[model samples]
Target: MSISPEKVFEVAALGLGGNIGDPPAAMAEALRQLDRRDDCRVAAVSKLYSTPPWGKTDQADFFNCCALVETSLEPEALLDVCLSIERGMKRVRLERWGPRTIDIDVLTYGTREQKTEKLEVPHPRMTERGFVMKPLADIAPDLPVKGRKVRDWLEEADIGGIKVAGDQDWWRAR
Candidate 1:
């Protein structure tokens, strides 16, 4: 769907990562693509982070980060955009928490709360993952997730091996 100039924008948070191939390059391209869209604009991006794998834990560490986007699309539509970005970057769902070229997750959409068969907003597991929270804190430390600030959650999240891999302008590189 195309957005007109008069469309109202909503601020949304996104979690992005990957463990295979040139994940950082793929992620930067994803952001560039999103920023080029008429319906969306990347407002803020967090620093890149090298973090231990979560969930499956057996694969290689992931390069992770978060982005704040101002978009005119609704929750489901935003999710569709994210999925399209992933697919375009050769993302494949071979296994749960397995390796991939790129992964983009919609963490929040304004103050909206949604749970549908295809997507969920304020991502159901955002608070439980340090990979998501740590980078998220860099861009939106005071942003609330489930009534608690992201920084507050960061304090409790297990960020053991997570480390900054790049500065906030990391996404600007080709």
Candidate 2:
């Protein structure tokens, strides 16, 4: 038996975060840019979440969300698109985990595991972030992470002050 090319699957999991000017608007613009790609389709999006800065907590809190997309592009190509969107949004990567006008990360790209100098699939640290897990679980409740259910991981995850920001649809329909 052999697997068919048509059956070869590809899906995209994107994590969006921003803390600089009009974070919500920046996210909406990112979604619109993703929607413009012919090889990808925005399938579902998680609710917006507000969480304290993870690493350098000396900055503004971040507005975060996750999006599940269906894309035929390989992980690296998809990553390129994400970076392009960031640049177009005037994103300034001044510091590690620092406040930004917009930030987009490829959290997962199908089940394919990949590592390159510039990108990593199934984002190495995604499972450890509550902001990522919370929204991911909401949209993909049964999603498996390191062999555990997303919901389960969320339960024990230290999400302290993370809160649902506003109407979920408000961001998606943008």
Candidate 3:
């Protein structure tokens, strides 16, 4: 069966992370797949960084980054795409903050406020994750979060070392 295209919302932000396998490579592949989706288009990508794992630090440090996508898919549908990418990368949900091949979370879906058993808009903990905020600021510094700019949030946020993974096409198709 084929899927029908819907009117895409102008902008969306997705947070990507992983600590297993080649994290940078997995992140890049996720972006490539996302960009290939008919209902979504990757508009921008933030610099990659390595950070101490949140929730649990016993595992390997996480490679993290964020991407801006233009899409017509609703929040849940968008999330499905992310989950598919994670599964394709062999993500194992053994424990919270446990090592995985890939992890993708929707940070924001346009400016809409939504809450359901399955998903939440403006990600419940976006402000708390340095991995999410740092890259978010890199790409959309002036973006408003809860009526305040992302830069302001970053300044007040308890964020630590975040190194930019150089090389723009590091994950591009050959």
Among the numbered candidates, top TM-score falls to 1
**Model 2: per-residue Cα lDDT over 96-128, one tens digit each:** 989999988998776677889989877888888
Q: Tell me the deviation in Å of residue 140 in model 3.
A: 0.8
Per-residue lDDT over 1-174 for candidate 1, one digit per residue giving the tens place of the 0 to 100 score? 996678999999999999999999999999999999999999999999999999998999999999999999998999899999998888989999999999999999998888999888889988999999999999899998899999999999999999999999998976
- Candidate 1's C-alpha lDDT? 0.94
**lDDT per residue as tens, model 3, 1-174:** 999875746699999888888889889989999888888899988878888888897888888888899998889989998998888888889987788889999988888889999899888889887888988998898888778888888987767766776444555642
* Residue 129 displacement in candidate 1 (angstroms): 0.5
- CA RMSD of all predictions: 2.7, 3.5, 3.1
Off by over 4 Å in 3: 1-6
lDDT of 3 at 100: 86
| Model 1 weakest lDDT span, ten residues long | 2-11
Score every model by TM-score: 0.96, 0.91, 0.91
Per-residue lDDT value at 3 in model 2: 71
What are the lDDT figures for the candidates, one per model?
Answer: 0.94, 0.85, 0.84
Off by over 4 Å in 2: 1-9
